[model samples]
Target chain A: MYKLYEFFASGNCYKLRLLLTQLNIPFQRIEVNILKGESRTPEFLLKNPNGRTPVLEIETGKFLAESNAILFYLSEGTDFLPTDSFEKAQVLQWLFFEQYSHEPYIATSRFWITTGKAEENREALNQKRAGGVAALKVMEQHLTEHQFFVGDRYTIADIALFAYTHVADEGGFDLSKFPAIQAWIKRVQAQPKHISITQQV
Target chain B: MYKLYEFFASGNCYKLRLLLTQLNIPFQRIEVNILKGESRTPEFLLKNPNGRTPVLEIETGKFLAESNAILFYLSEGTDFLPTDSFEKAQVLQWLFFEQYSHEPYIATSRFWITTGKAEENREALNQKRAGGVAALKVMEQHLTEHQFFVGDRYTIADIALFAYTHVADEGGFDLSKFPAIQAWIKRVQAQPKHISITQQV
Candidate 1:
């Protein structure tokens, strides 16, 4: 059996949990409350010196952190990772997009809004919210014709982006503005073995 | 032929250049000067919407961004990526470590210190420098025993970590404190096809 150390609300963690369910892989879930600073404790830091969440622990007790990286780890040699060279690179491209362009804006806005800290830095939060919308719009434009993120199939790329994008509403970004993204989300949820983010493995 | 779009001084770009040399993979280097804001132009953004480097343009003209992602792409189905399941995960583990823990601290501190922006944020820069050194110390501990980042072999894990760890001194973290890392650097450099970051493709 494997173990997943995660925060309930994290899209990064949720991405991995969703993959586990879709793959029918059995794993124990250990909740690390980031709001309570559980990740900073010596015990947790020993597992991942970076002090972040969504670490996957294998049966041998070795811990792997970073949600996208864990998704790669689990998806290797599977259909989730495209076998074609170009398609594979495309997967990596979108994963990188989710990190640099998308996460910085979208995740930050979600953090500020959901935690109700947006009032403290209203101007900055607003700017971030706008940027988040911009990123979502990029996805919306792409999703208009494509059923999934990279290829014509469901992949970790979709899982990676969907984790945060689906929750963009919590960050005060209006999802209704992007009908393509709305349709794409429904398409993803319609997949077999799909699991909700809050569900336990 | 493969082409790499990169900035002259970016470690992210340098990582790919380093790997290409080691693998004897011929590539044309296209320099995108970041200081002049070349990455923001519409033409560059079309290649990579995130507008960062290094973007590896395959023979098909499809571009790929994100340094770690590019590393994974080029190294796939090759010896640079580990074949074993757990070893492959370990490679990803360190790649993620480089991104989350090492890059935020080490790369940022280096940018501030080397580029002489430390005066503008001396206190904050000092705090970051300390954090960067702490990360280096963690690497020192790991390198003290392991020959490479994983499985006693030179994989992309070493390539990813070495890109920054070798030049961490530019970040204001004294490398002399970590003799094991120095030894590890020498080990990586001693490899048959290893190339210095200064030497461009």
Candidate 2:
């Protein structure tokens, strides 16, 4: 049976849980609270030296980390990942962009704010917000030209991006300025069997 | 023909060029100097709105960015990328770690230092160096146990991490402590048909 080691509030974990639900795949979710230092425990480190959550125990003793990697693993050979080579590569590009450009700014801000640590991280947040805005602008431009991130269809690319993007506002990002991204959010939400960011099952 | 728009100093660009050469995949490399703001030009923006180098034009007028994604595309069918589903996912995990954890810290420091911008960005470099060291510590821990990043085989995961890691000293990181990583670098370089990171062919 599949098992997921995750923190409920994490977008990285959410991305994996959301896809598993969308695909109607059954799995068990075990909470690994980062704030409490659960992920850094020696046992957890054995599973993932990186000490991050959303680790998928694909089978007994075999595990995978990195939410996008987990998403790709579960979605491959299914409609969620494209069969065409170029489209597949495009999906990967957006996943990398989400982690590097989008998440660092948007997700981290949300984490700091949600946990009441914003005051201590104000300067960092200000810098991150600027980056967050730039990332939103990039997404806005892309969504204006294409309905979806890759192949003009709802795939894991949209799933990977949708994780933190729909909730970027909680990170102090003003989404109203990004009309295209706003519309794309609605399109992704409209997909069949879609689950909310924090939902499980 | 495949055309790679890249900056010679960029580890991201080098990841693709290294893999293509290792796989005996013929491709054209066009240098885009980030120092002169060439990648930011209107013409280059048409290729990648993100304005980053190491964009792979897989075919005429069609492009893909994000270096790890490009590596995945070129190496999928070859031995560089594993055919097994689980092994492939493991490779993706490392690729994401390289970009998010390793590259930002290591590659950015190398850029600031190499460009003589470290003095102006002292605080940023110091912060980046700490992160770079932490990332190296993680890799050192991993390599201490496994010879390769995944399946105990040489794969694109090695190439992706090697791009920035082999030169991390340029970022003021002391690699003398990461004995395992130092050895892994030699293993990757010893691969058949392997090319130095900055080589064009």
Top model number, lDDT: 2
Q: Estimated TM-score per prediction? A: 0.89, 0.98
Worst 10 residues of 2 chain B by lDDT: B192-201
| Per-model chain A TM | 0.95, 0.98
User: On a 0 to 1 DockQ scale, where is model 1?
Assistant: 0.50
lDDT per residue for candidate 2 within A144-200, as digits (tens), equals: 999999989999999989989999989998889999999999999999998897655
Mind giving the per-residue lDDT tens digits that candidate 2 earns over B17-91? 888777777888999999999999999999999889889997899999999999998988888899999899989
Tens digit of per-residue lDDT, candidate 1, span B52-117:
778888866578778988898889888889878778777877886777668878887877777778
Measured against the true two-chain complex, the DockQ scores of the candidates, in the order shown, are: 0.50, 0.90
TM-score of 2: 0.98
Angstrom error at residue B161, model 1 = 1.5
* Residue B134 accuracy (lDDT) in model 1: 71
Candidate 1 backbone overlaps, count: 0
